[model samples]
Target: MSPEPQATLELQRTLVLVLDLCGTFAFAVSGATAAVRRHLDIFGVLVVSFAASTFGGISRDVLIGATPPAAIEDWRYLAVAIAAGVVTFFWSPLVERLRNPVRLLDAVGLAFFAVAGTEKALAFGLSPLMAALMGMLTGIGGGMARDVLLADVPVVLRADLYAVAALVGAGIVVGGHLLGLPVVATAVAGGLACFALRLLALRRGWRLPVAGGAPPPDGDA
Candidate 1:
């Protein structure tokens, strides 16, 4: 690759690490909160928390060519998640009672990871559609894994904006790239799009249109 392209790739990798750490921590907190709510044992909580936060990123990386993934590389990603889990284990009561904080932090993780994943895919010269899909995976994969662990329906399958927000964020990044926008600017715009969409979904209960033209539940059919 050209030097410019190489530099951009490096920058993308660095940003992925930074954002991954934040996302990992946030995911861990979410899992820990769940475990605490269920009154799980300490060992189970730690394992679930660590796995919930990192498995998605690991899965994304492995699919896109990063074998073993950064989550398993350098140790910091897992460390942060594990630490957060351990901390939350001791602070179970506080984390469990505060639903807003869990949602807020999970949103934070989703926004950053979506942008980071999309940017990384673009950096690797992937197609826009694939890039967006990867971004959504990065944002929601962990939570899906988390839900599966807890034996609940995946959040992405629910009537919520989680996956939609990730897709919008990634779409912005892909569009900006197609227009030759700078990487950082594209990432910022994409991340903001995800954040805004998530917050809006939370505030207004936005959901993806249903299949088969399901009639509105408000008697508007």
Candidate 2:
């Protein structure tokens, strides 16, 4: 590879790393915020934060055959998550003052992770469609895990446009790549597409249609 191509590749790698870490931090804050609202203990808050932020990336890495996973190999990821947890624990009142902070913060995490996950998947030689699916999973998986831990239905299943937003974002990245866009441009476009769609859904009450005409009996009749 020539000097110019090598430099471009290095720049792309750096952008991906920065975006991935940003997603981790955003998810951590979102998780900690949820825990605070649930009145969880400090340890619980930290655990939720760490799991919410890292597991998606870890799962993606594992599926892509990235041994040990970045979450396991990278100390910064855990450090950022713990820091976010501590901040949310001490700043609960301020966070609560924000209207629906959990939903908003979760949207941010979802967008970032969607884009980052797609890029990482592509980098690891996955097909574009598979990359998009992985991206959607990465965006929503942590939240699902968090909800399960809280004994609540996952937002992706309950909320309208949740996973849809992720899929749109991943699609944007894949499309941009196919069109030969710069890595930074593709990342920004994809992240913004996801974030904007999610926020719009929240504001406009957009939702996917559910199954109907089904009334199951309780406990075998």
Candidate 3:
């Protein structure tokens, strides 16, 4: 490969790594907050944080045949997750005081994870459609795991436009790649789109249509 192409690839990889780590931290904080709300001990809080931060990435890597997933192989991912968990555990009152902090952090994580996953899937030679789906999975899988551990419904299954936001973001990344756009530009655009859509959905009470008349009182199926 030429020097310029090699440099671009390196930059792309750097961007992906940054996105993944940022998403991990955001999700970890959200998970820790949930654990604190549930009155879990420090160890339980760390467990939940690690699960929420790394489950999606691990699942994506496994499906793509990237054995020894980055989360497991990379010490940075674990360190970031544990740091976020400890911070949240020690500062529960401040974290909880933020208006709907969990959802806010989740949106940040969803944006980053969706874009990063799509990029990795595409690099691994997956079809654009499959890459997009994988990206959505990468965005929502951690939240599902976190909720399961907490004995609650997954936010992706019920939250306003949760999975839809991820899909849209992933689609944007794939679309940009197919169009020969710049990788960094596409990633930022996709992440911002996903984050904005999620927040907008939450603010405007947007939701998919419900079955059997209105949605249940608690927004479950």
TM-score of each: 0.89, 0.89, 0.94
The model with the greatest TM-score is 3
lDDT of each: 0.83, 0.85, 0.91
User: Against the true structure, candidate 3 has what lDDT?
Assistant: 0.91
Local accuracy of candidate 3 as per-residue lDDT tens digits, 118-150: 999988889999999999999998889999999
**lDDT at 175, model 3:** 95
Taking all chains together, the TM-score of candidate 1 against the true structure is 0.89
The per-prediction tally of clashing pairs is 0, 0, 0
User: Where's the lowest-lDDT run of ten residues in candidate 3?
Assistant: 1-10
Off by over 4 Å in 3: 1-4, 100-102, 219-221
Alpha-carbon shift of residue 47 in model 2 (angstroms):
0.7
Q: Residue-wise lDDT of candidate 2 within 1-221, one digit each (tens)?
A: 12327776787678767877888888888888889889999999999999889888888999999989888898998999999899989998887786486678778888989998998898888999999999998898888878888888776786689899999999999898777777778889899999999999999999877567333553122
TM-score winner between candidates 2 and 3:
3
Cα lDDT of model 1 by residue, 1-221, tens digit: 22447777778778877988888899899988887777789988888788788877777788889776778876898789889999899987787777787888888899888988887777667898998999888888888888888888776886688988999998998888788777778888888889888988998978778777765765234
